[model samples]
Target: MTEVFENSASFASDLDSKDELQSFRREFSIPQKNGKSVLYFTGNSLGLQPVRARKLVEEELAKWAQYGVDGHFEGGRPWFTYHEHAKKGLSVLVGARESEVVAMNNLTSNLHLMMVSFFRPTKSRFKIIMEAGAFPSDQYAVESQLKFHGLDPEQALIEISPREGEFTLRNKDILQVIEEHGNETALVLMSGIQYYTGQKFNIKAITEMAHQKGAVAGFDLAHAIGNIKMNLHDDQVDFAVWCSYKYLNSGPGGVSGVFVHERHGDNPGLPRFAGWWGHDQDSRFLMQKGFKPMPGADGWQLSNVNILGTAAHLAALNIVLDAGWQKLLDKSRNLTAYLQYLLADLGKTFNDFKVITPEKPDERGCQLSLFFYRNGREVFDFLTENGVVADWREHPLNETSERAGVIRIAPVPLYNTYQDVFQFSRLLKLALEKEHERITE
Candidate 1:
């Protein structure tokens, strides 16, 4: 399917013509570069803020300014249930029961909290498995969890990798590692979509495999949450954590969410690092001596929810809910497939380029990781100079063996249009051609 996007302006016209979510683009404040809106394909890094975010935040501020101490209850949409507003929408997005999901701490912190409860390792079966090239934050969080449990991360943590000359992890290989290590593994933790390679793992199969080995399964959905429809309940994942800043379209530093399967909701004895927020509301202000946990994921909370951040998250989630996840994911698949096509087409003209993201649309998300054989950094700098915004992925030192990293071009569906993808393809061509000319001289 060769879909033609002639130019950015024509792409915008085409975008305006058929974009069911075009109104949503207006909802966000698009950043300007050189008097033109940047062909932003970096929503995998930070989402553009919804214009309603300011209004939502101001509501909280108004409540605080008016009610002060009484804002906990007296204010309309009381602070007491502030997080409830975001739950149903987020549940819809991730396909989880309302009781199973909660808006809470940031992603890494939530991962640590989930690990505290779920990562129970005995001396004999104490290994934790994760992808070798997971986001650095996840790596550090897992390492901290290992140390917190009085175990060595280097020893207890099992990192999976692809074979030689491979760019993405094969599903069978990942399952094989899980099966091989399931006997000794305490928990199986992996990213829903790899941050660097943008590979969307086989979550359902992986979750079942982890359970078959008597291990709990979890996901760091920082890159997957809104990039794709995550059927957490259908997948039967034990627990999951994700940040709102990326594909969720929440502004920078937005609050995160956690999912605990309904099966684990009633497990009151599950060990956790609790705070007053996790206590029952009836006894919460009573200054109870003991920590009797609330039921479900809410019981995992470690602090009072961030009302302002949650408000920002709600504005974004509202748009997502209105658009419907099925439609968004469909756009994502088509948008990314078109992007891959454009990249492949560009590669036909530019010999030194290779797309590091998987060819199969189902195997990857919206981001395409690109490997430039020469002048990669200069090319990246040039793209930025010409109003294209993407990111660079630093390779795992162990995997790279002293090679440079690749540039990641993530064209998020919520805000990016076909024009954005086409323009990026054009700029990539220009960047490479300019680099070639420079090198020849």
Candidate 2:
């Protein structure tokens, strides 16, 4: 049997004292409340900025100032190949070859671009399959893509949802849907980690199932890239896209990344929206009419690199790389496990408190979604007012049901500590107690 953890501040302090990555906490500038750093637990929404990000961005700004238009080739890092500096680091994060990855446009934009090449619809196989409650942007992108092909989204979009009264989708159910719609499904685009429920999907299995069904498989790793371990190439996923602003520690609206399996990278006949930057480096400046795309994922680029955004991403990737991916993932698993344990302890005191996120560590990353039976908004307000920085989502599982509100706490391994998790648990307990008293009064 496993040992039970005590719900005590001293126990949390003990855990912190033994943590190897505790020093990483000082590397970020934590938000302050009442002269103290707030208990920030929303890294899943927007990661805390790395202290080195400003220095990296300022370096690019200095290059632009010193070299003017010549910064393209003259600067130390050089604007011409700035995105390359981030490729190696991002490749390790997404588990792909450097040639297969490129830091480029934002997440939704990259998704659209990938869809241009991958979402080939025909009368026989013209449907797109996706998770029912995907982020709004993904939903909109798929709908628009269908319409662009002169297909009605209502007829061509297939959504696989959780069974009634369930908060998360079962893997078997998802696979069964793919089997049922195999013939008509043109694409299978789903999140590696479902953002709202903090559920991590089996990417390799899903990709295999999609392939078996004669459907192209891709993923939106907006919540998965930095939060979990992925092997996109080994998984045989056709393409994947992710944003850097969340767990990646890049600034808000930072440049995103894409992965095109090597199999698809060299196909000259693949359809894509082309631009000058994606032209062969040797012949790019020749100003030739016919487009010759560079090999690999870079061939999909629509414009020159976003220098400032790339700089910020480079800095953040450096931090992650320095810490080591395996080490970070190990810490992330433990940190989230500790948070879940504490939340369960709190649930013992508050009958209304429920954890909707999966109980198994392998099924989740660093986030836990807490569902309150009542006073959900009021409790969220209390946590905010008390200096606990978390996120709340009003997710309506179905049209006929009331909104299912949840408070999401992500104990990011890069900065958050065991003590932070303990503090959040304490605050949450107090908030629930207060809510209970107010109701009884």
lDDT of each: 0.85, 0.90
Best by TM-score: 2
Can you write out model 1's per-residue Cα lDDT over 182-214, one digit (the tens) per residue?
899999999998888788898999999999999
Clashes of each: 0, 0
Q: After superposition, how far is residue 239 of candidate 1 from its true place, in Å?
A: 0.7
User: Which parts of model 1 have CA positions greater than 4 angstroms off?
Assistant: 1-12, 398-403
lDDT of 2 by residue, 1-441 (tens): 114677889988988898888888887889999999999999999999999999999998998898899999996798888889988888999999999999998899999999999999999999999999999999999999999999999899999989887889999999999999989999999999999899999899999999999999999999998999999989999999999999999989999999999999989679999988888989898898999999999899989978988888999999998888899899898878788888887767678767888898889888899876566888999999999999888866744434348899999999999899999988888988898889899
C-alpha TM-score for every candidate: 0.95, 0.98
Worst 10 residues of 2 by lDDT: 395-404
Give the backbone clash total of model 1. 0
